[model samples]
Target: MAGLDWQGWLTIGVVLATLALLLWERFSPDKVLIGATVVLAGSGILGVRQALAGFWNPGVLTVAVLFVLVAALKSTGAIRWIGDWVLGRPRGEFAAQARLVAITSPLSAFVNNTPIVAMLTSAIEHWSRRSGVAPSKLLLPMNYATILGGMCTLVGTSTNLIVAGLVHQQPGMPALRMFDPLGVGAVAAVAGGIYLLTVGRWLLPLRRSALQQATETREYVVEMLVEDAGAMAGMTIGQAGLRGLAGSYLVELVRNGELHAAVSPEEALRGGDRLVFVGATDAVRELRRLSGLRPATEQLFKIDDAGGRRTLVEVVLSAYSPAIGKTLVEATFRSRYNAAVIAVARHGTRLHGKLGDVVLQVGDTLLMETDAKFLRRYGNRAEFLVSNEIDGAARVDRPRALVALGVVAAMIVANTVLGVDILLSAVAAAALVLLAGCVHVAELRRSLDLRLIVVIACSFALGAALDRSGVAALVAAHLMGWAGSDPFWTLVLVYVAAVAFTELVTNNAAAVLMFPIAVSAATQLGVQPMPFVIAIMMGASAGFITPIGYQTNLMVYGPGGYRFSDYVRVGLPLSLVVGVSVLLAIPRLWPF
Candidate 1:
């Protein structure tokens, strides 16, 4: 107390205000953390190098590189393949959850959980459509599974790597190994997994995703031809994952000029077989992305070779349109506009027969496959009243999937077996992915989550301010006083504080802020700092009670259509299970 200075007090105040703003949701976390870092840097509490050091931190750079690596995997269909293979044809919801947790946990152990969640969210949604399970039933469990998996390894989540980086800076403190947390983290994951699969499963509400809840105002009848050499050519309808589609149904299958209505799930698909589907706009959009299928019209091939640069555009025919009364075949829509009408909807009515025979009318909405430049060229044209590109409808490079997977595997081997640093391994892997043409440079740039990286980088500045200003020591003294010289109780207090901070702020920021205090507490007790450090690492990731607590939680929030109380209902108990398991295991593995 006697050593406390004005700098310490200012850092404390700034941290409190930052936390308040974060909890208040007044601004994004990057802005809040950056604002606090600026204040501390301006006050000379931290030098420019220290304030900006996080940007160059190995952990932060590794995170950025991993984003590109994951993007490559996603772009090349490696992730979707993994999901489909692992989550294969589960009979019921329980089996689905079990399979999901089984795969997500282990995969998340190596990859960053954010992109994993993002990629798998869509996959699981599509799976739900086919399996007759509600997305709300699966998304939360999957999110939690990723969090639990993240705890088992240092690279599993950014929080663990950030803490390890902070530990490396401390004199005499040993750096964390890849599997240092495995002892406690594995136990906690098992316990948490059991709870989520059993009691937690029952606690989840049977809800629909935002897309499912929306009314289908524009139902389009789309015809897709099975490609002769594609993966789905010889597979049964059910085997090809076309059996059950949410908000959409197969109306008929046209084979050899014969119409097969009420298509059976066991029907075998042949090359050039035309499958007709009636679905809402969202469902149609998803259908466009399916592999082994193309728009049934030959006009699509006549468009200029956009190749991977093609996108889906939705436009409403205006009264002044030249082909308002003409059929698409007569209008030569593809040649004139350099686009193909994949599907069309008129006044919410399902148009039957061939798409080319449909007469264009005023107010008809046409979903067209066109060059990426379509929107910019036609946005203000009188021929269309509305023109917009469908988001997330990009061409996937399935051919390079194996290359992306191989690169990831090599990176893991280099990092874990060959004694290379994770940042170098990640950089090499990302580079290899680009060099192999798994993902384009533009896609790589877009995949980097700058907001998350900024929040993490700026958080290091706050952590530095806490350590440099002696606030960490002061807080350590208070923590010791609260624990009354008992190391076990002191460990409990540190873990509790970490969990509170994580739930209130964020996983990365919580780990950063708590690192100094955990180390200081270990120092004041004359005990090994590793246990306290491990406590902070595990505790910071145990945030399951609030959506705002974790990025993966928020990612599923809208898609799952969950209430805030939903997390409380299921996550509260799961948190207790994980916390108790971690607290009991940490002291044994890394003895104080």
Candidate 2:
């Protein structure tokens, strides 16, 4: 065995520190990753090019392009339509989960799972309300199903592409075909989905939204407008999906400057009509996203051009605030604060008439759609007791919806059937969407998730350092020593180790770091590396036990109001089921 060199020791130390700090969760993951990358480069453990190569890696760029493409699809309403159409109202929660699995499985195979989850989060929430299912019950399944779906195809997740990249790097190793991993991946997904539907549903945490969480404040009053020629225009209140909404009521309607008290459910809505609703904050947020309904305020339009840069912030009035004693109209919130109030929540109090006429008081929580700079400008001010930005909802562009769908279809066909390079196809598809008016040049920058991109890029440096310094080989030798020379058991060890690392680190990082180690173990055993490689790919993406392990898990974390234990309760078993399924199927499908 080779003794540990200085570079190997340094690389090991850096990797350990990064893992420790990540578990601490005090700093951003990107900062920690970049810091480690710089350390490896500065210590001469890795060349500058090797350290920065991740930034230009095809895997990283493919993920970035897919993010933008998904954004175009989202903003154009393509994803929403697909969700509604495929996941038709099911009679029960189990059926709803099954429907979601059916829809997400196929879609995620062709698209990246991050945007697939992002697009489905809201749709699932809405479905839960309409179908009497808890969002908690459905959301975790949605995330898991998407992860499972990603395993079925080479282009499904960035992790798969990273594995494919490594496969291409090894001399004499054939490039992975698009469907090379499909058999094992598909089996695992189906088994995992079945597990979730039966045993997993009972284990899901029944978390209530913050709005409904407190009995002291059961509801809040808000207003919405019927858009011109929208889904709700000319429809009676009963027909506009305003009736029978759980824990919500359409209280009144204002039209032509006249207040119509307790407007009958039979009254048809017009473009100019203002509808008053009494509901929990969660329901009102869902209302904001329904097709053809918008906030009644004209101020929201002023900042719509900012693209995705705008966010929703919760601001509480303080006793000393200048706006506390005045109405929102009198305070000129849009002008003074550079934000528009979308909704307000006050304790057990009923708000009457127009939102502009409501008098502000200390402790009133205002839900405002603010500019990117709003939090920085007002976050610390004594005038507001609290100013925190929350997740803003996605908006749809009806005009460009079909164009986005067409571009996605073309990319899938060109890559899978026509044998075009996946990266080239993705780039072309992204370009086509932008030119076809599905997304604008100005909006393109906002679509990228820079934090995810940065972390992924830096992980390449870490992976290279591990490989070049012989640390991966050292670890593999030790692992093989414990596995007793059985290649199949060694494959299981590789998979379990990858899964452990994935739960601790990011999925892409886990895959990148494990690829060399898996190959080394296979080489040591004098067996084919494809089984170990396939194991790494499956295990790395199966990060179900924790939110930090996967982006999609965190995406649904806050929106679903999930506790950390919630994920563990449901995801732990799902992970085990997937692991066993993958282990049983990989060797049969591809003998070592």
Candidate 3:
């Protein structure tokens, strides 16, 4: 063999560097991509002028804007409102929770899943308190639904958008439509939903939560007098329906003098008995109004507001934090942080805690209740991961929400009816939303994850380097040499490789890396390049292996209380099924 060119050697070095970084998990994939770009630019494999390609990639811009859109919906409390409806509806406990996943999954199809989970976690915790359902019962469904919903459209997930953009870049490639994945993806997603509803539920590792749902929502040690005519005077605890309080629960009952914290739900409640209810002040007010009761004048027990401005915060537990492997009781978040963790969501499992001793895991989301400024004060500490709350502070103008909704709708309609350039329409719509004051310029940056931006930038530069170095063609020729005479099997293998690579790296990176190979393979096989290019695009969009493979997966991971294997258990099989589905569809839909 002849000596390799400088570009070839540089390409080999780049690939080796990537492999070493990934093997060690030494840095975020974003860092890896950026580093690759810098290396290629320095080596002259990527033209200095081409280095900016990723910043302008339509796929990157689409994902960024979609993040902002989802953020806007999240800030509006729309997702939480949906979660509230799902959790509060009168239905069988499991059935109601299942309905929550069903609703959330489809909503994810239209919007991004991460912000959806951030908004819904709070609502589920609220339901856990009022309905006395284990938070563990609801969080898994939330995660599954988001993944399922991501299958609805090309823009539903960043991976899909990246793949679509890749196909658009190919000289002979066909342009993908908005609902390009609707047929196969929807079928797989719905099937995935069914899997979660039945088999996957059984496979989840159920951890008993630390927070026990008391008879009361959250008991405030308030004193109550036994009145002859009061509703509690003649009734047993079971008959009082203490759990039905809108915002609280009655956990302890005090009579004339004796205190009881272990009262059963079925215990009798009698009037004139000094009782203690673990409830918010407003709930107490409603209880008093409905029961016609008087407040105790003498201090009976310390009554703090039910979780004092209960807020849902997503906290990333850091490695150096005191909470790392310890339970809440051990961490003393209540005493130390002055916060009550109602639920802990990690991966696909939800662990409930009673402000007691539930050990924490890295990346676990503590569904907490505290003063608004309390957690914000400790946000920079090492103990907790960065937190994001769906802030509904901006006074939402109904007209603004309506107009924003209208713009997004118009863009979608235009794209579908007239085949308008989606990126152009969407960019215009985003501008309109900004001009209408729906979103400020300063807030836009936070909406999109910078990880995605870096990944795109790196992938674009890498693609250019591959084109310049001719390394992609060399690899593709070798791969094609193994195909022999049958074209169908080669195409299937190509798709499979793309999907596999996507599972290990960012979708744009997968596309950029694989597209050059796909094009080269088509040339060697003497076949239409469209089939191979489309196969790569389809495969790159598939992210049904690990939660780390996709941003949407990570979004739901901490909130779902899922272990790494939960996705492998459910997603691996679905991925295999979808792989075959794509293999069958691509040939028929776009014909070689």
The number of the candidate with the highest TM-score is 2
Model 2 quality (TM-score): 0.73
How many clashing residue pairs, candidate 3? 47
**Per-residue lDDT tens digits of candidate 3, residues 1-592?**
1445978878878976775675455465667878888888888777777876777777777876665565445444444455555556645556865787678767776666655665566566555556766555666567667765775676666666776776676566677788776665665566667766776666555533323322133344345565677666667655665544555444356665655543555666666666554434455565566463577777444321333333444565643356666766466465576554544555545543232445666566665544555533664343443454423232345666666667767777877788887687677777777777766654565454666577676677777677668887777766766766356777876888787776776556777788777777777777877677657655776676786565455544564455688668766766676566667766676566
Candidate 1 lDDT, 274-367, residue by residue in tens: 8866555555666677899887764222211223444555566654467878877588676577665655655333354456567887556665
Each model's lDDT comes to 0.77, 0.75, 0.62
Q: Model 3 compared with the native: what TM-score?
A: 0.70
Q: By summed lDDT, which 10 consecutive residues of candidate 1 come out lowest?
A: 299-308
> In candidate 2, what are the lDDT values of residues 1-592, reduced to their tens digit?
3588899999899999988887775566788999999999999998898899887777788787887687687567677677666677788988888888877986798877866675566577556655666777787888899999999988888899888877876777888877788999999989998898899888988765332232233245557888888988888877877755654556456688665544555788899777766555666777876788887774222211223443556555644467766876588665687665645555423343345656886556565655666654665354654444554344456668877888888988898799888789989998898788787654566556677789888988888898899999999988888889799888989999999999997788899889889998999999999999999999999999987677677656644657777888889989999999999999999899
Best by lDDT: 1
Q: After superposition, how far is residue 583 of candidate 3 from its true place, in Å?
A: 2.3
Task: Flag the better candidate by TM-score, 1 or 2.
Answer: 2
Candidate rank order under lDDT: 1, 2, 3
Steric clash pairs (candidate 1) = none
lDDT of 1 at 64: 76
Task: Give each prediction's root-mean-square deviation over alpha carbons.
Answer: 13.9, 12.5, 11.4
lDDT of 1 at 165: 80
Once model 1 is optimally superposed onto the true structure by TM-score, how far is the C-alpha of residue 502 displaced, in angstroms? Answer: 1.2
